[model samples]
Target: MKRILIINPFGIGDVLFTTPVIRALKENLPDSFICYWTNERVRYLLEHNPQIDKIFGLSRGDIKKICSKSRLRGFGALCGLLRNLRKEGFDIAIDFSLDHRYGLISRLIGIKKRIGFDYKNRGRFLTDKIRIDGYADRHVVEYNLDLLGLLNLTPPASRNLELIVSDEEKEKARELLFKAGIYERDLKIGIAPGAGASWGRDAVLKHWPPKNFAYLADKLIEEFNSKIVILGDAIEKSIAEEINGAMAHKAIDLTGATDLRELAAIISCLDILVANDGGPLHMAVALGIKTVSIFGPVDPVVYGPYPVSPKHIVLKKDLSCRPCYKKFKTPVCLRDKECIKSITISDVFDAVRRLL
Candidate 1:
């Protein structure tokens, strides 16, 4: 294929999962142009990526409209997006987003080869569908790379994910920290309290609560003498504020302040990152930074840190319905997210201590 378009207009972590496939495509099909389409907020995730030739940002507003109750607005926006994709004359279209809209749009745009997961038989919309039962007990990186099977090509040995942060970005990240009075001597702990599935959908769903994070931050400050920084987009500033407000020791709140690349660079400077099972956790793992992740509703097997390095530690409660996040957009848990509630501050404290 001369022109390949990967549609992954979703969360930052999901976009990161496709990095290996991008590298494989660039190495195996060296001459082809690979275009990455993702949420506008996450375009920075791919801009410096050497494997991807072009990074296209999809509007968050349009995506919300497409997923919202307003059918007329959603359909109109989808049609416009469909026309735009058709105009690109893509030789191959891959829908890593797994949302039916992108798969349907690929089909409607007349792409000969469209690939995606066939969850709940959405295979009707995708030309080449790979089916997997409930959440596959494997890392999401391997799951995303499975799409490459459509070309009858085997994956390369080195599946190391890539994120290119320029030296300039590194300098800026240091500057931001320096200005915050966080010297090089201080141990930095980054806390990303927001997840797209959690905050955008339901705060109580896939998230480990704000109070827990607040308590954890205080414990780190008191015990480890670590400087904490809360990371998230503007939409999550309120959540960040809640955590910061509840904390005894003040944390540098960079929520709604840094862009995606900036966030990546900042994360690179962290001694260890502590976060919920979401984007920032994946970002830290990819950057090769030590991370302590709190898992509740989501299964650690599916979304946990890949390559299972000692640097990445996941703390999850043992429960029969631990992965209830998979059952519905909002979990159907009767005990009010007891899975997350059960994971005490001491549990996370122990995990962070091990990494520190």
Candidate 2:
């Protein structure tokens, strides 16, 4: 194939997980030009990806507007995207979304070969369709890589993500830490205070109580004598600040203070990370930093830490509705969020101490 397109319309963690697929494709077909289409907010995660020739970002705001406005706008944007694809003359298009929408988009683009999962309403439009085994306990990375097998490509030996950090980004992160009064030699623990953007009260409830986090922070300080760094985007600044505000031991609130690359750089330097099951957890795993990730509604087995080893610890309670992965209109349980609340600050503190 002279040109290829890989579609991943999701958040930072999804983008990171899919990088191994991109790397496999590049390794198999070195001469082909590969491009990725992803959400605009997280396109930064793919910067300096050697496998990708170009990255296309779809604006969420524009998508929202298109859905709200005349249907013509959405179709117009699709047509524009199709025209762009035609101009590039891609020989193969892969709908990694594994959903009907991306499958339909691949068909509309009219690439010579389209490949994706054989989901409901998905086989009609593609040249290659692979039926998932419907096997239990399969990870998402494994599912995504199965697409390559349909193309007669062998699966790579391992699944891992590589995030590129520029020299400039490293310097900037160093400056940020320096300003925060952290020295290079000091032992540090990183904390991700907020989960990813979510839909309703479920989103707010996913977080551990601020008091719980503060309690852990104080214990880490008193026990380990470690400096704490709270990581988040601007949207989560308030949450990070809330945890910081409640803590008697001061934490370096780096929320909204750095971009993705800088955040990765800062996280990589840390001795350990304590976080919710979110993007920062993924970053910590990729950077080979020890992390203790707290999970409530989500199952750690499916989207858990990569390069699984002793360094990574996932804590969760076993509940009937524990794996309520998607955000629901109503609460998953009668107790609202017993899973998260049951995860005591002492549990987290003990995990961090052991990891350290």
Candidate 3:
């Protein structure tokens, strides 16, 4: 049996973009054992996917955390992870990480065939690669599927993002909603105001004003009698609070309340998710829930909802410098984020209305 390893040490959206590739691999090579290597934080997202036979999680932050506690333990941990990969005897590795470090590690682990993108000439160690400057022309899902061609594998016709939500997760979400006083009959709408952990400190650059979100939530409540829930991580509780503070009506604050899997569960229970371009927005799309996503510097064509269907509405301003986020880099905006800030509340509310 062939052992194939897929490496993508990135955020939730980047990893989810590879789901179609995983599905294609499983369909074409049913007997192959597929292992996914990702950041520990995002490992939960792939836990329920049956196509992935095994998952290995390791990140620099994990190593740093361990090293901070004990240097010897950290070194041993790295060695142990590398040793385990060697023992797995993986034949081919499909790497989505543009970093050369993953390619070097795959080589050291004795993987014979390495396939990936040669971004900035980082694929020097890759045996076969497609050279590109960045994800500019097409959706990331299409870019990921392109790597399959190197293996002589046919890409799946349907390239929809895949996320498997367990039955237990669904039940837990229901319980959380019930406790929040959101009944089954209530029209549930989720708003994720944060830009996700991937953007780090620059997350604020992607955020529409919290006051705008507050106004939009109140409008949604008034028009549809919707139960709005503020969704985000613990770090984003302040943003949620700000939205709550500025709002005319109260919203169920769930920021920092659920883990990544539970967040998916909660999003699954929502009729529609209105979010800035980030992980939660993609999660909703993966779960087949409608989404009205706000885009700032990022281009919706390259990173928007995968299928370009009516179920997903993208709200953005048409400006030359708007999609400043190109080739995985965003330049400092001098326009005070006019791209995102220009997207009026009415525009977003109308998009949400279309989806609802």
TM-score against native, each model? 0.89, 0.90, 0.98
Residue-wise lDDT of candidate 2 within 308-328, one digit each (tens)?
689898889988777766422
How much lDDT does candidate 2 score? Answer: 0.78
lDDT comparing candidate 3 with the true structure: 0.93
Q: How does residue 137 of candidate 1 score in lDDT?
A: 70
Show the colliding residue pairs in model 2.
none
lDDT of candidate 1 vs native? Answer: 0.81
Highest lDDT among the candidates is held by which one? 3
For candidate 3, the per-residue lDDT at 341 reads 94
Give lDDT per model, in order. 0.81, 0.78, 0.93
Off by over 4 Å in 3: none
For residues 1-356, write the lDDT of model 1, one tens digit per residue.
57899988767677877888888887788899888877777788887777787777765455675668787877677667667778888888888765676777677777788887887776677888788654557788888888889877678667766677889998999999999989889999999887655346565466788999999999999998999999987888999999989988899999989888899999999999988878888888888889988887778887788768889888887888767666234455688888887888899889899886
Candidate 3: tens digits of C-alpha lDDT, residues 58-142: 8666777899999999999899999999999999999999989899999999999999999999999999999999988789999
For residue 175, what is the lDDT in candidate 3? 92
Name the regions of candidate 2 deviating beyond 4 angstroms. 59-62, 65-79, 132-136, 198-201, 326-331
